[model samples]
Target: MNNLLTGLKNILGVGLKPGSYLNILYLLLAFPLGIFYFVYLITGFSIGLGLLYIFIGLPFLLLTMFSWRLFARFEGLQARWLLKENVEHDSPARWSEASGFWNWITSRLSSKYTWKGLVYLLLKAPLGVVSFIVTITLASVSGVLIIAPFIYKFVDYELPWGAISTMPQALSLTAFGLVLGLLSLHIFNGLAAVFRWLSRNLLNSGQRLAVAE
Candidate 1:
C-alpha cells in the first residue's frame, strides 16, 4: 500500500520536480540545435568531399572531421549537464603517446566512437523535430486551457470543442489542463531518457571498448 501511494505521488508530482523543467528546457533547445548541427555537418561533409581532388581539399576534410568531434564532445557535456547523465566521453590519444601528429590523428579517426558520434549527431536532427513538436503542441494547449478563465472573456477564444464563455467551463478546462501538463512532463522525461542512452552509448563508449580490448 505504501509503495503504491509513493508511486502515485511520483506520477502526480512530476510538475513540481525541478528535473521536469530541465527536461522541458532541453527539449526546447533540441529543435534549433538539431537544425544547426544537421545543416553544418551536411554542408561541411559535402564541401569537403567535393573538393578532395584539389590540394586544398585535404585541409577542408580534416577540419570537418575535427568539427564533428568537437560537436560530439559538446553534446556529451550538454547531456551530462541538463539530463544529469554521466557520459564518459571518448578521450583523444595524447600527442606524447603518439609517434607523430599524423599518428595521433589516425588514432582518433580509427576509434569506434568517432563514427558512432557522427551517427548520433545525424540522428539528432529528426529526433529533435519530433520532440520539439510534441513538447510545444502539448504544452501550448495545456497552457492556453489553464489560463482560459482569465483570458476567455478578454479574447475571442475558440477551441475545437467550442468557445468557452462561462466560468464553469473555464474551470473545468483548467482542471483538464493540469492533468495534461502532468502527462506532458512524463513524455518529456521519456524523451530525455532516450537522449541519455544515446549519449552514453555513442558519444563515449569508446573508452570502455578500448579498455576491454
Candidate 2:
C-alpha cells in the first residue's frame, strides 16, 4: 500500500516541479521553429538545385548547408537551457577567423554532423506539429474544465454525463480538471524528454571539427 501511494504521488504531483513549465514552454515554441526551419530549408534547396547549372545555385546550396548547421547549434543550446540536457555549445562547428574561410567550409562539408543535423531539422517539423497539437489540446480542455464552476452560469456547459447546473456539479468538474491538468504536465515532460534525446544524438554526437592552421 505504501509503495502504491508513493507511486501515485509521484505521478499526480508533476505540476509542482518548475521543470514542468519549462518543458511546456519548449514544446510550445517547437511548432513555430520547426515550421520556419522546414520552409527555409525547402526554399533554399529548391532554389539552389534549380539554378545549379548556372553556377549561381552553388552559393545558395552552400548557404543552405551552413544555415542548417547554425540551426542545429541553436537547437543544442535550447536543449541545454530548457531541457536541462548537456548539449555541446559549439555543434556542427562554426567559422573562425584563425581557421580561414576555406578551411571552415571544408570542415563543414566533410563533417557527418552536417547531414545528421539536416535530418533532425527535417524530422522536427512533423514532431513539432504533434507536440504543439497535443500540448494545446490537453491544456485547453483542462483549463475549460477547471474554470467551469466560475462560468457555468454565464455559459451553457454540458459534459458527457449530463448538463452542469448545480454548484456541486461544477465543483466536481473542477476537481476532475485539476487531475487532468496534472496528467497533462506529465505528458509534456515526456515529450520534452523525447526531444532532448534526439538533440543529444543528432546535435551533440560527434567530435568537434579541428580547425586547420
Candidate 3:
C-alpha cells in the first residue's frame, strides 16, 4: 500500500501542462468508440442475439482486443505534446487493413499486443467508474465544506450527505472544506498513478518494431 501511494505521488508530481488536460479531453471525442465497444460486448455476450452478425461481431470484438495500441497512440501523442516524450510507433504490424478477414484475425491473435490491448479495453469500465466516483465525491465534499460556513447561521439546509450533522455555521466548517480540497488532490494523484501504470503496461508492450513488409 505504501508503495502504491508512493507511485501515485510520483505520477501526480509529473509536470503536466494545459496539454495534459487536452489529452484527457481527447477521451471525450472517443466516446463513440467507447459506446461501440460497450455494445460490442453486450451483443457478443448474448448467445441468441448476436448470431446474425457473428462474423463481424466476434471479429470486431476481438479486434478491440488490440485497441490498446490505439489508446497508447493518444498517450504517446500526449507525451510528446505535453511532456516532450517522443515515443516511436512503428508504422505497421499485426493489423493489416488489406489482409483477408482470417489473416487479420490470425495476425492479431498471434501477437502479444492484441492480448494487451484487449486487456486495456477490459479494464476501462472499472477504472472509469472508480474515477467518476472519486472525482464527484471529492467535488461534492469540497463544495459542501466551502459553502457550508456561508450559511451556518441561517435556518438549515440538510446536505444530501447526512454526514454533516452539524450545520456548517462556524469557522471549523471552513477548515473541513480545506480538508476536502486536499483530499480531492489526493484522489487525483491516485487516478493519475493508476492511469500511468496502465498506459505503460498496455501501450509500451512492444519494444521491437514488428512492421510487416
Candidate 4:
C-alpha cells in the first residue's frame, strides 16, 4: 500500500523532473519539424523524380539524399539530447567517401538505413501531430479545470455542458484535472520511450551491418 502511494506520488510529481519538461518541449517541437520534414521530402522527391528524364534529376536526387542524411543526423542528435539515449548510426565511410559522386550516391541509395530513415521521416509527421494534439489538449483542459474555482469566483462565465457553478463541483473538477494532468505526463513519457525505440532501431542500428561489410 505504501509502495503504491509512493509510486502515485512520484508520477503526480513528474512535472518537477527535468526529463518531463524536456519531453514536453520535444513533443511541442515535433509538430513543426514534422511538417517541415514531410513537405521537404515530398517536394524534393517530386522535383527529383520529375526531372529524371534529364541529367538534372540525378543531381537533384543526390542532393535530396544528402539533405536527408543531414536531417537524420540532426534528429539523432536531438533524440540523444532530449531523450538522453545513445542513438548510433553508420560510419561516414559507408556512404560519403566513395571514389566518385555516382558511387557515393549509389552507396546511399543501396543502404538499408537510408530507406529506414525515409520511412521514419514519413511517419514522423503523423506521430508528431498526434503527440502534439494530445499533449496540448490534456494540458489545456487540465489547466482550465484546475483553476475552475478561481474562475468561478472572479469571472463571469457559463459552466460548460457538464460543469456546475458550485464549490463542490469546482473542487471535484480540480481533483479530476490534477489526476488527468499526472496521467498526461505518463502518456508523454510513454511517447518519449516510443521515440527512443524508433531512433535506436531506425536511425542508429546499422553498425552491425557496417561491421559485416
Best by TM-score: 1
Alpha-carbon RMSD to native, per candidate: 2.6, 2.9, 7.2, 3.2
CA lDDT, every model vs. true structure: 0.86, 0.88, 0.54, 0.80
Error of 1 at 115 (Å): 1.0
User: What's the TM-score of each model vs. the native?
Assistant: 0.93, 0.90, 0.58, 0.85
By descending lDDT, how would the candidates be arranged?
2, 1, 4, 3
Which residue runs of candidate 3 sit more than 4 Å off their true CA positions? 1-36, 44-90, 93-106, 153-168, 205-213
Residue-wise lDDT of candidate 3 within 1-213, one digit each (tens)? 999998876555432435434434333333444445556555555633465365655644554444555654665555455434444443444445737766665554555555555565556666655665666676677776677756655635455654333543445667777766755555555565565566566654464325454
CA shift at 160, candidate 3, in angstroms? Answer: 14
Q: Which candidate number maximizes lDDT?
A: 2
Local accuracy of candidate 2 as per-residue lDDT tens digits, 142-194: 99999988998997886677789998999988999998999899899999999
Would you list the rank order by TM-score, best first? 1, 2, 4, 3
lDDT score at residue 164, model 4, on the 0-100 scale: 59
Candidate closer to the true structure by lDDT (higher is better), 1 or 3: 1
Model 4 alpha-carbon miss at residue 37, Å: 0.7
